[model samples]
Target: MMTTIAAAVAAVALASCAGPGSAADDAGERTLTVYAAASLTGTFEQIAADFEAAHEGVSVELSFAGSSDLVAQIQQGAPADVLASADTANMDKLVDDGLLAGRPADFASNTLTIAVPPGNPAGIASLADLAGDDVQLVVCAPEVPCGAATERVEQAAGLTFAPVSEEQSVTDVLNKVTTGEADAGLVYVTDVRGAGDRVEGIEFPESGSAVNVYPIAALGGSEEPELAQEFIDAVLGADGQRVLTDAGFAAP
Candidate 1:
């Protein structure tokens, strides 16, 4: 009987040495990485903060860049749990390549604007003003969503602009205007809002012809599919839509 009791005691000691709830705790704490377009930085950061506050034992890591660049990274097999593109074309490309888990939903929309330094130092007023010899224009490259939208607007307006630089992202275009690198730039209304008094947004009627829609989805190889879906839902749900709308994004 003493031997049997000692054996039971040994089993208890072994169990104690195994560490209580260590495995389960480790499993609960996971990091979810999200790749999103640069223009969504302000809005998504707020969403990420809200998500982390609501979820216990979970952390979010965000990587923001141009939508085209983000898509290329995902195609190259970068580790990303979620992807939010500024335009549907790049997301559609991923869907066509079978890289995404499901159909991407249009989460939000934005329109292009001409951003200039506060007080309109160059006396620029409209789209035609950008074509003046004295106006130095900064625009996004054709590969980026904002650039493509700008192209459509320009074409629709039958206007030609000799841009001083073709930036990689819309934020870069805004930066040029804020820093006085250019007299004006074609950027999104959301970007202008995010600039926070750094630049003034000019809305042109031609911009209505080329509104950009943002789409988001979970990647097929995401390590945290559940978290990715949660983020996507927050972007499409009422609260998320409110945030986007407050930031100058149009409803999808």
Candidate 2:
């Protein structure tokens, strides 16, 4: 009895040292790293949770930023398993560099919108209102996907707006408007929907001129390429498309 008890205690100690969590947990569990555009945060977060539930022992770690910034990070050797861009242009940059393991699949599309604070205090009703001198407008930097889309809208509408601030990400533009730091901001239609009642979205005809097509791909150098590919598949599949559409993203 003493010998058996001693062996059991030894086993417990060894198991305890195997991981930082539960003793029964496998130390080699896969962590799929996803670098995605900031616009995808809410939907992707939900997808990650569902993915974790569906694939035991696999967890997803997401890094969200502007599509351009994410691409720059990947180019500079960030440890990313998958890349999801808010627009095809940024995704193409990585694919052209041979950083992707497979062809990037277009997952969804989005269009621009004017996000204003509750009640639209500034009374912003159209794209022209954004160019008003008294209106403090915020927008993503021109290099960002949303910014590029906004530029296209401007060209189509034959109007120009001088924004008070140019943000790094669409999220930042939304934050400014939601927090009353700016009167209005240009962001995606999905972003305005995601913001709920914090901001009111105004649609203009010009938005249709420039739509952004989002794409996702597994990185060529991913440590767990299979897991990364599976993750991409999950995002482009029925379940993932449901979550995205529910969040206001258009089917690709």
Candidate 3:
């Protein structure tokens, strides 16, 4: 009788361990990966937090880098459910390559600004000041969105600069200014906002001619298309627009 009782308890324990609702099955929750431009980092991170709060059982994994680098990753078939570029040109490249699920949408826009150290020690005030031999400048690589916008603004102002460094992202350009590595750097207006008291933003009239439009879309071959689409919608919705606007991004 004792042996039979022990066998019965062991069998029940084993059954519970092998039940239909086991831990292994519960681990099937979905995780969505999003690759986005570096400039969108702060705002997108807040958006992701809000999204996770509203959607249970879903996780958003965000990767932030230069728009061009993100585009290259997507083209190389990185496992991303969504891609957001700081400019439409890179997005068009992905779309042309047939890597996006549908047409990309312009979610936000921004213009270039000259970011300077907290006090503007160089007595810099305008675009032409950047060309002074004594003033060191940092700029994004021409291949990146912010760099391209800077180039356009420079051309519009008929000015030239010899930057001390060509950074890979707008954030890097801002960092160079904030750290005093360079007297001035060309960066997105949103980045200037993000920097807050760490740096000061100087407005240049030529920046208006070089507005940058940020585009986002669901990637092709995504495992969670529906969720990806939902994320895209959220980014374009009222709440998302407010976040972008508050971060100094302009309407498309």
TM-score of each: 0.90, 0.92, 0.93
Q: Show where candidate 3 strays beyond 4 Å.
A: 1-26
The local distance difference test score of each candidate is 0.90, 0.93, 0.91
lDDT of 1 by residue, 1-252 (tens): 999999999988876566656553675588889999999999999988988888888898999988999999999989998999999998988999999988899999999998999998998999999989888999999999999998999999998989999988888888889999999999999888889889898889999999999999999999889888998888888888988999999987
Candidate 3 residue 134 C-alpha distance from true site, Å = 1.1
Query: Could you list the CA RMSD of all candidates, in the order they appear?
Result: 3.7, 3.0, 2.4
The TM-score that candidate 1 achieves is 0.90
- 53-157, model 3: which lDDT tens digit per residue? 888878999999999999998888789999989999999998889888999999999999899999999988999999999999999999999989988988998
Please report the TM-score between candidate 2 and the true structure: 0.92
Best by lDDT: 2
Better structure of 1 and 3 per lDDT: 3
Assess candidate 3 and give its lDDT. Answer: 0.91
Superposition error at 69 for model 2 (Å): 0.6
lDDT of 2 by residue, 84-157 (tens): 99999999999899999999999999999999999998999999988898999999998899989988998899
Count of clashing residue pairs in every prediction: 0, 0, 0
